[model samples]
Target: MASGFSLKDQLFNREKTRYLAGLFAASHAGFDPDRFEAEVMAELPALELKQRISLIAEVLSRHLPQDPEGMAAAILNALPPPLDPSLSDDDFGDFIFAPLGELVELRALETAPDLSLDVLAEITKRFSMEWAIRPYLVHWTDKTLARMEVWAEDENYHLRRLVSEGTRPRLPWGQAVPLALSQPLPLLDRLSGDPTRYVTRSVANHLNDISKKDPELVLTRLRQWQAEGVQSQSELDWITTHALRGLVKQGHSGAMEMLGYDPAAPVTAHLQLGPGPVRIGGALEFDCMLQGPSDAPVLVDYRLHFQRPGGKLSAKVFKLKQTRLKGGTARLSKRHPLKAGASTFTLVPGLHRLDLLVNGIERGSLTFDLLAQAE
Candidate 1:
C-alpha cells in the first residue's frame, strides 16, 4: 500500500529516523544521532521482519552498490542480540526479534571472509533454515571449495552441516543455483555415507534439482551408486522421479527408455483427415496402437512431430492415460483432433516426419506427404 517514494527514500526519511531513535532509547542504548543514523541505516532494521525484509534488502541493494562488504559489516554490528529463547513463541517477539537474528546471519554471509569461520559456524547453527547465505556459497571458487572442504570435516556438525546445507539447490527459502547443483555431487559423495541425516537430506535435494535439467546425468550417477551398492532405494526413487518429471511432461524418448518402456515396437497408426490443411485453418484426427510386453504392464506416451515448410521438425508429446498392458500384450490407443496451428504444419508442401514418442524415451516415426493447393 505504501508507494511513491523509492525504498531508499522510505528508509532514511524523517519518520524512520524518529522511530529508530525511539527504539534505541527504549533499549537503553546511548545514541549519537548523526553517527547512529549513519550506522543504523547501513544495516537497516528488519523492523517489519521477514514480511518487510525485501524492502530493507532493496534499500541496502541500492545504497551499497559499490561497497557491499562494508555495508554488510555495518548491518551485522547494528543487529540486536538473539532474543530470549523463552520468548520465541510470542507473536510480537517473532516480528521484533527473529528479524534481528536473521539480519545478523544474512550480513554475516555478506562479510564472510572478514568474519571468523567460527562465527559463521555459530550463525549457521542457529538459523540454518531462515538465514540467507546462498550468495556466498555460490560464489566459492576452487580455492574457497578447498577451504570449505576442510570445514566440512570439522568436528562441529554445524560447520560440517554448512558444507552441504549451505549449498543445497532445493533448500527451502534458498535461491536455486544451477552451478551449485552441478558441483554438489562430489560434496554429497563425501557426506552420503555419513552418520548424519542432516547432511543426507541436503544431498537428496541437491540431486533433485539436478534431475530437472539433466535427468540422464542424475540417472547415470544413480546407476553408478546402485552398482556400487552405496545408494539406498529411497535415494534412487527421489532422484528418478524428480529428474524424469520434465521429460515425462514432454514425453522425451530417453525418459521412457530409462523407465523401461520400448518405443520402437511395431504398431498401427490411423489418420482421419479433417478439413484439408489450409493457409491457417484445418484439423486432423490421430489414432494409434501400442503393444505392451508379456510380463508387465506398459505405460506409453504419444507424441506427434510435424515438419515445417522449411524441412524443420517440431514435436509435441501427449500422455495417453488409458493405455494398459494385459496378459502378453497391452492395447494402448488414443483419438485426438489436432487444430491446424495446434498441430504441426508447413508453410510449403513437403515430406515431414511425425514421430510418436513413448513414455518420453522411445520413438515411432511416420512420414506424411503434404501438398499445399493454391487458393
Candidate 2:
C-alpha cells in the first residue's frame, strides 16, 4: 500500500490497489490477473488522480463483459452489498469503501450505451455513479432527464442528492452538463424543498455552481425561498450562505447585503505577515485589527495569492474567523500553515502575497518568501 492523498495515490491503499486486478480476474472471464496487475500498477505511479480513474475505467472496458447491460450488472454484482443506511456509524465511511464507488462510476459510463437507468439506479444505491451519469446527459438528454425525475423521488438520500449533484452545471472534477448550466432552476426546483440534509447540501452546492455563472438566478431563487418561507429559516440560511459563498468572497454588494453585511460601511483594517523567509514547514503568523465608526456588521476573510507552477499567481481564500464587532475595536490573529501534508496543495518555494479582505474589499497586502525546508 502507498501512503498519500492524491487520487492516484489514494486509490492504491492497503488492500484495493493490490487486489483490484485480482477482483477483475476472478469476477470476469479472460482477464489474466498477472497481466492486468502488472499493467495497472506499472502505469499507476506515472499518472495523476483523474488519469488513474480513467485508467481503471479503461481497464474495466477491456476486461469486463462485452454486452453493455451485462457489464453493468456484473459490476453491480461485484459490489459487496447495499451499504448500511448509516454511513457515519459503519465501516461504510472508511476509505476501503471508496473503491466500490469508483467501480460504480466506471460501470455507469461503460454501460451508458444501453442507457439503462435501472442499472444506474441499482448501482447508485451501493455507490455513487454521478460521473457516469454525465455521458447520458450529453448523448440522451431527454431520456436522462426522465430517469433523473424518477431518481428525485427515490427513497435513498444518496440518490436524491445525486439528482442535484449529478446535474451540476460545473460540478467540480465531474463532467460539465451544459444544459443544466443554461437552465439550472428547473432541476433545482425539483430538489429545492427536499427535507434530507444530504440532498439539500447537494442542492446548495448546485446553486453555488450556478452562482459562478449566473448570479442573479441564484440570488432570485434564494430570495424567493426566503420569501415563500417553505423551509425553516435555519435550513434556508445554510443554503443561502453556502450558495453565495463565491459572491460573498468577491464582495458582491447584493450578496453581502443578502447575507446581512453592510458593505457600504467603513472600517480600518490592519494586517501583518511576519518573520519573512520562513521554512516550508513552518507557520506564517498574522495579526489583524478592525476599527469601525459605528455598530455595523462585517464579514472578514483572507486571500493568499500563491505562486503557481508556471510562475503565475492564483489566489485562494482561507476562512479566518467570523464575529460581530462593537463600535470600537477588535483584534484577531492566526498562525496559518506554510507546509503541505496530505492536502491537494504542494508546498513550493517561491514568493507569495497575502491580502486582508473585509466585506470583500482588499484592505492590506504583504509579500513574503518561502524557503525550502531545512536539511
Candidate 3:
C-alpha cells in the first residue's frame, strides 16, 4: 500500500518501474527498447512524487502521438478497465495512480474539455482523478457540474464517490474549488441520500468540509436527514456522527444536543499529572477521576496546551476514552508519549497544561514542567 506521505517510494521503486515499462510495452510495443526505461530510471531516484509525475508526463509528451487529443487517447489506452478488477488487487495503487492519474492531470487540463471529461470519467472509476478534475470545475464550472450531477447517479460506487469527493469545497490533499466551496448544497442534496457506504462516506466528509465554514447550515441539514429517514439508517448515523465530529469536538451546543449529549448533566472531575519535570520524549502518565450522573454516557477527551519556543501556547485535543459510568465514580489512567519524531510538533521544554473535557466541556486542568531536551 502507498503510505500517505511518500508516494515516490511506493510508486517509483524498481519493481513499479519495470511494471510501467511492461504496461507501456504491452499497449504500445513499438515505442522503444532501452531508451524509455533509461529516461524513467534516470528520473526515478532524483525526484519526489510530484516531480516524478511531472517528469513522467514530460516523457510521455515526447513519446506519445504528437497532438494533445491523440496523446490523451494513447494514454487513455493504458487504462485497464473502469471497474473490471477491484482495486484490492495490488496493481491499483501506484501502478494505476502514478502513471495514469498523472497523465490525466498533465494532459486533461490542456486538452478539449469533452475529451478530458471522457478520460477523467473513466480514469476516476479506476483511481480518483479528483485532483485533475478541479481545474475543469473551476474554469468550466457549469458544464462540469452538470456532468457531476449525472455522475451522482452512476451505477458504479467509485463514480458516485467521485461525485462527492471531487466536488468537496475543502478536499484535503486536493486543490480547492472556490465554486464548490460556495455552493455545495445542490450537490449534497443530490448525493446525500446515496446508500453505498463508500459513496455516503465521501458525502459525509464533503458535508464535514462544508461544516467548517458553515457549521449551522451543515447541522441543520444533518438534523433534517436524520429526521427524513430517507437514507440507510446505519449509513446516515455514520454520516451524522462523522459530519458533526469537528463541531462536536469544539463543544458546540447544537452539535452536542444533536448527539444527545446533555450539557447540563451534573459531573465533577479531578485531573492528576504525575512525576513533575518529565523529559521530552518520555511518557507522561495522568489520571482523570470523575463522579457523574449514574448510567450516563460520557465522551472523554483531553487537550494539551503546548508552549511554543517563542512562548505562545497552542492547544490540541486528543480523544481519551468514551464509556458509560454505570455507577458512582470512575478513575481512568492514561499514558501520553512525548516524542518528537515525524509529528507536527517537536516536544519543546516549557510549561504544558493538560485539560479534561467531559461531554465537550473542559472541566479540569493541570500544568506540568517539561525539562529541556537532552543534547
Q: Which candidate model has the greater lDDT, 1 or 2?
A: 2
Over the stretch 110-187, how does candidate 2's per-residue lDDT look in tens digits?
Answer: 445444566666666666666767767776677878778877887776777777877888776776675846454666
Report the lDDT tens digits of candidate 3 across residue range 239-304. Answer: 888888888778777777777777677888989887665778777789988888887777788989
Candidate 1 segments whose C-alpha is farther than 4 A from its true place: 1-51, 56-131, 138-182, 191-205, 208-216, 248-255, 265-289, 302-324, 329-357, 361-375
Clash-forming residue pairs, model 1: 251-360, 252-360, 252-361, 253-360, 253-361, 253-362, 254-361, 256-361, 292-330, 301-359
For residues 1-375, write the lDDT of model 1, one tens digit per residue: 343545544534445654544444444334344554465455554443344544433433333323545544443444445333332222122222223334434544445543524344444443442244455545544534665677667654545556776676566667655454568677766665544545555555566566676777766766666576565666555545554655566655665566565555443333333344522233334445545455543555565565554577676666665344455454444445433333234344566445555444454555655545444
Q: What is the lDDT of residue 348 in candidate 2?
A: 77
Q: Which order, best to worst by lDDT?
A: 3, 2, 1
Residue 282 of model 3 has an lDDT of 76
lDDT of each: 0.50, 0.71, 0.74
Candidate 2 CA-lDDT value: 0.71
TM-score of 1: 0.47
Model 3: worst 10 consecutive residues (lDDT sum): 87-96
TM-score of each: 0.47, 0.77, 0.89
Clashing pairs in 3: none
